[model samples]
Target: MTRIVNCVKLGVATEGLDEPPFPGDKGMEIFENVSKQAWKDWLGKQTMLINEYKLASFDPKARSFLADERRKFLFEGNNEMPEGYVPPKD
Candidate 1:
């Protein structure tokens, strides 16, 4: 059976990740409180952040920036789009 968590991002009880998506304490926190769907959503946003800022994944500073942004997005509900980003029209 899938684990269910009272997702902090979705504000509902839903299917949780099998394991922490991240590492260490933050990952454990997410594994305990965030849903699978919310983590997937963050993955998309994280990609956009990486592309928009031209961030190097191997760089420590870039990794730190993404970690901070992830916490803010998941735990604090602060989903700031990249500057001057426009959504594609359907």
Candidate 2:
């Protein structure tokens, strides 16, 4: 299911939506069917840790918002820091 969404997002699939507030397209039906409240709940739980994790660090409160693997994936870049080390203040 996620692969399908990723494909749609990456344009591997040609489907598209007509109106938003509800998303459109061929492969996005599942996402389109999800409740708006659920979408907000998911967003509230987000912690963006990938690709640019070292630009700063995620605070514990933000880390707490994400699932474990997502947390790891966000900060565990090449040559990982020691377990308890926080990103230094800029």
Candidate 3:
């Protein structure tokens, strides 16, 4: 009996039993992926908002203490952003 059982065990081990899907794999993976995407989207929006405000509130040339680059931001030219910009990553 022991010899027969040992052979059965060897066969099963060599054959490799399949496992059922993990209970939490799908939920955990989706949560992690969405969390990562949300963070990237938030950072992109922050950078864009900072640039927009920096331009919208500009005090131009007469404020000689400011740099030339700063002077150019007083008003939007042909390069103005759309009425309301929303990054598509979200």
Candidate 4:
């Protein structure tokens, strides 16, 4: 049976990830409080953030920025889009 968590990001009880998404306390926190769907959504947003900001994943600063953004997006409900970003209408 899949694990269900009180997802902080989605504000609902939902299916949780099988394991922590990253290494360390933050990852464990996410594993405990965030849902699978919310993590997937963050992956997409992270990609957009990297592309929009021209961030290199190898750079420590970029990684730090993404980590901060991840926490804000997941725990704080701050989903601010990058400046000048226009969503494609389908």
What TM-score does structure 1 among the candidates reach? 0.94
Q: Between the candidate structures 1 and 2, which one is better when assessed by lDDT?
A: 1
Pick out the ten consecutive residues of candidate 4 with the lowest summed lDDT: 80-89
Residue pairs in clash, model 2:
16-25, 17-24, 17-25, 49-74
lDDT score, residue 56, model 1? Answer: 100
Q: Which candidate is the best by lDDT?
A: 4
Better of 2 and 3 by lDDT: 2
Residue 80 lDDT (model 3): 37
Q: Provide the lDDT at 31 for model 4.
A: 98
lDDT of each: 0.94, 0.36, 0.33, 0.96
* Tens-digit per-residue lDDT, 1-90, candidate 4: 999999999999999999999899999999999999999999999999998999998999999999999999999999999989987689
What shift in Å separates residue 17 of candidate 3 from its native position after superposition?
Answer: 34
TM-score of 4: 0.95
**lDDT per residue as tens, model 3, 5-26:** 1112122212211221124764
TM-score of each: 0.94, 0.24, 0.25, 0.95
User: Residues 1-90, candidate 2, lDDT per residue (tens digit)?
Assistant: 222222222324423333233345521443543333333433432322332343233567544424444323222322343356565489
Residue 35 displacement (Å), model 3: 0.5
Q: How many residue pairs clash in each candidate?
A: 0, 4, 0, 0
Poorly placed runs, candidate 4 (over 4 Å): none
- Give the Å error, residue 59, model 2: 19
Question: What shift in Å separates residue 78 of candidate 1 from its native position after superposition?
Answer: 0.6
Model 3 alpha-carbon drift over 4 Å, by segment:
1-34, 55-90
Candidate 2 vs candidate 4, TM-score winner: 4
